[model samples]
Target: MRTQLSIPVTALAVIALAACGAESGPGSGSGGGTVQPDVPVAGVHWTVDSLTVDGTRTEAPDGAHVEITDKGRARGNYGCNHFGADVSVEGDTVTVRPAEMTEMACGEKVQNFEDALRAALTGRLKAELTDGRLILTTEKGDSIALTSQQPAPLVGTKWVVNGLVLGDTAASLPAGAQDKAYLTFGKDGSVRGSLGCNRFTGTAEISEDSIAFGRLASTRKLCDGPEMDVERKLVKVLEGTATYELNHRSLTLTGPDGEGIAAVAAEIPGEK
Candidate 1:
């Protein structure tokens, strides 16, 4: 759910309230009002509960969400599309400015839900943090409700490729390629994966913001058609330095220049 910015009066009011120290509850002294604790929006993955547009209630489509990073980058699944944008938060006011998104087509119901979400998130919205929920309401009465949850870490996790970036577009693997590509990162800085045909292993350099793989060694197995093409591309991506973003059970790995891959967490044999 991403769009361009338009700060509404309600958002302005939130900024003013924060600036004036007009807390939501009573207190005294320099801290004359009881200040509500700031909601930890960054680093936490939020799952969508419901979306209301122009006073009409609508349920969020499956896998809908919005995640904001401390660095102001935002990424989410808007029911029918995957989007990334820049988000700024001042006081209780939050704004999402569009960047890039996948242009995948979907059914009418999903498209409608995505449209509503885009409208609600675009421009400036009044934000409220209560209990464990974060609500964003527009001046026009459109709103989105989300529940926060801890995100899964990338290190020492197994992931299976779901989609790959070709040039500027992202698309799912060709038919018959499902579950054939996967990668497992070890605590010892090693990574091993199946490239849909042969198994490969390599060392990886990981940091807070990026990852680069060292030389990789693989089995000499022959594959034809789509699987072979997938293997070649997957190995190329691994060989390049890629920036990664993780949200809950999903991971997106993009090269410094644009190419990348998207994957979902894979369950270990004994893990719950």
Candidate 2:
């Protein structure tokens, strides 16, 4: 003979409830379901929609955006200034340390936007991505809403130097030297450009966030004192460049010792 043991209906129901609760323990969804994965924030370009500080919300001025790469680097335009910094992400929290930015003067409105943006990014913030939008909320209740978009391409674009890094400082081109310093990257990995006073050609090796110029050949024509000085510094910095970042229409080249160049996109012929 065989004996069958059956559990009571109430006890079985309790057991089922316990198992369900275990599956949706701490950090689970509101309905006691599995926790959703953290939203991906890296390697995406974001355009600012609104930035709220304290309790007041302000629309982002033109040209305000942020791009965070998978390599833990962040670069953006703060309406008036271009900035870059190292970004660290852990779970749903992101921390963007104080960034280095160009000191371009802007109107009062743009300046205020920059000030608020800089303050918002100074420390850690809770990050949430929903409906293709990124929301960064600081512990103090400041929030920035950004819409994700495709970033501008870097290759096959002409760039005009707007500022150059000399030692530890960034300086704009000489007063009369607009559009004189430029760089163009060809489809064949060749770089041709003017170093303010002389035409230069070189082989450039470019990777996902980096660029290195090989032995460069340039015209030997001599120029004025200021132009020559600009050429000398430009050549040195280009030769030493190890990495590059492109944000909107701006390009930043960084060298081994924190030296770099900042350039804006130049309108080139036959290119839309």
Name the best candidate (by TM-score): 1
1-272: candidate 1 lDDT, tens digit per residue: 23433212222223333443454434423545554534454455666778887677888764566665555466667644677765556766666665576676555666677666766767777776666676778777788787765555677667888677745566666767766898988879999989989999998888887889999999999988878888887887889687887768678788766877777766543456
Q: Give the alpha-carbon lDDT of every model.
A: 0.68, 0.65
* Model 2 C-alpha lDDT per residue in residues 1-272, reported as the tens digit of each score: 11111101111122222333346655554565753322344555567778899899999865566665544456666654666665545545655544467676555666687678667765567766556666777889998787765544566778887666644466555655656888888878899999988999998888988987898999999888667777776787778446887776678787777777777665544545
- Displacement of the residue 230 alpha carbon in candidate 2, Å: 1.9
Model 2, CA-based lDDT: 0.65
Off by over 4 Å in 1: 1-44, 48-64, 68-75, 78-80, 83-101, 105-148, 247-249, 255-257, 268-271
> At residue 92, what lDDT does model 1 achieve?
63
